[model samples]
Target: MIMMTVLCIILGYLLGSIPFALVIGKLFYKTDIRQYGSGNLGGTNAGRVLGKKAGISVIVLDVLKVVLAAGLASLVSEPAAIWTSLACCIGHCYPIFAHFKGGKAVTTMFGFLISTSIFIFQEFSYFLVPLFMFLIILYLFKYVSLGSICASVCSSLYITAQLLSLDVNNLFIILASWLMTLLVIYRHNANIKRIQEGTENKVSWL
Candidate 1:
């Protein structure tokens, strides 16, 4: 079991480290995406640097990597699988290939949520109430950082609620989710400061 768990984590991390944004940017536009925009290899930065279509593609690819990692992990036993998923999330946030600097793992978390089957489409209305409310607050105020922060907080809350309500036996899931939330918040520290100073970047869509 221990060996299997370690193997799963290594596999997930390798999968998560495939910088899709960087690859897509170079392939489509012959540019290093990290050189432009926020100097981060993430979908939002990709969008800001390479227009909407390329940005959306990068987002989808990143999300797909998360899904692949989590889904493969799910094929294993309970706690081990959860640990593997968490490892994947950590890899996205701090990829070894990128010198321990990576994206914020927002879309990766989205994929994790979707792959876990926590809230199906039928229950999405209930799940989305808080999500939409957060979006509104972020959109109206024109603070993308605030919106993302709120969203991550709400995601942790939702995950905790689900774990409790479902009586999940896997403690790793709870631990991993909490850890991932904290990591997301930590990654956004600069954004948090920008928000406090009233200088955070707003969504262009807003």
Candidate 2:
């Protein structure tokens, strides 16, 4: 079981480290996304540096990676699935294949929320609620960073509440959610500072 869990984690990290944003930017535009915009290897940066189509494609690919990782881990056990999801998020943030420099992992975190909600927790609301929250926040403010931060916080709070109400003894899900939330916040520290100074970039297309 332990060996299987380790293997699942390795698989998750490798999958998450695929760096779809970088790949799409380099392949289609002949530009490296890391050298442009916010220098983030995330979907939002992809949209800014590349185009809407490239950004959307990168986001879809990022989400799919987490879904695939969690699905494969679920074959082993729920704990493994949760761990794999966290591993994927970490890899997205600090990808080994990307010179250890990666995005903020906002999309990757939501990907985990979607995958774990379906494969491990069997609770769709965990994914849907945060997604709705993100969309509403994004539509209103046009700040992807703000929306992502809010969504990450909402996911953690919702998961914690659900675990409390349901009396679920397994703390792995809650741990993973909190970890991802912190990671999102940590990765967005620069953005947060910019927002305070009223210089944060807002999505012009929105």
Candidate 3:
């Protein structure tokens, strides 16, 4: 079991560290995405430097990586699947293949959450709740960082409900959610500082 868990984590990390945003930017635009807007190696920055199409594409690709990892780890067990999801997020945050420089873990985190919810609840409503919270917050505040933080916090309420019910099956889910929250906040520390000084960037998406 332990060996299988370790293998799942390694495989997830390897797949997650592919740096899709960088590849897309370099291959098509002949530029380094990380050297551009916000200097982030994720979809938002990719969008800023590469345009809406490339940004959306990167977001989809990043989400797929997490979903793929969850699918593979499901063969092991629920806990192992959660571990794989966690590993993928970590890889996205600090990709080994990218000199340990990566994005702020927003898209990747959402991908993992949506994928896990699919497998755990197998219900569309399970994905809708937090997604609605995220979109609403983003739409209202025009700050992607705020939306992400709020969405994760809202999702934690649902996961915490699962935990409080004494559902052993959800133990790993709760653990993974909290870890994602901490990692996301840590990654967004700079954004948090900017927001505090009312200097955070706000993109109007209408």
Local distance difference test scores for all models = 0.70, 0.89, 0.84
Point out the higher-scoring one by TM-score: 2 or 3: 2
Q: Which number leads on lDDT?
A: 2
Give the TM-score of each candidate.
0.86, 0.95, 0.95
What is the per-residue lDDT of model 3 for residues 1-206, given as tens digits with 9 covering 90 to 100?
A: 88998999999888789799999999999999887789889988888778888889999999899989988888888788877988998999899989989988888888878777776656655567778998998888788888888877777787787566566767667878888888888898999899999999886422
Rank ordering of all candidates by TM-score, starting from the highest: 2, 3, 1
- The top-ranked prediction according to TM-score is 2
Compared with the true structure, the alpha-carbon lDDT of candidate 1 equals 0.70
- Alpha-carbon error at 18 in model 3, in Å? 1.2
Show where candidate 2 strays beyond 4 Å: 165-169
Please give, for residues 115-170, the per-residue lDDT of candidate 2 as tens digits.
Answer: 97899778899999999999998999788998899999999999888785544435
lDDT per residue (tens digit) for residues 1-206 in model 1: 67877888898888777787788888889998778767777777877788888878877887777767766666676565556666777788778887777788766765655545432222453336445755787768866556656766776676567665544553456667677668778888988888888877776731
lDDT, model 3, position 65: 95
> Which stretches of model 1 miss by more than 4 angstroms?
118-134, 165-170
Which is the winner by TM-score between candidate 1 and candidate 2? Answer: 2
Candidate 3 wrongly placed segments (more than 4 Å): 204-206
User: Backbone clashes in each candidate structure, one number apiece?
Assistant: 0, 0, 0
lDDT (0-100) at residue 199 of candidate 2?
92
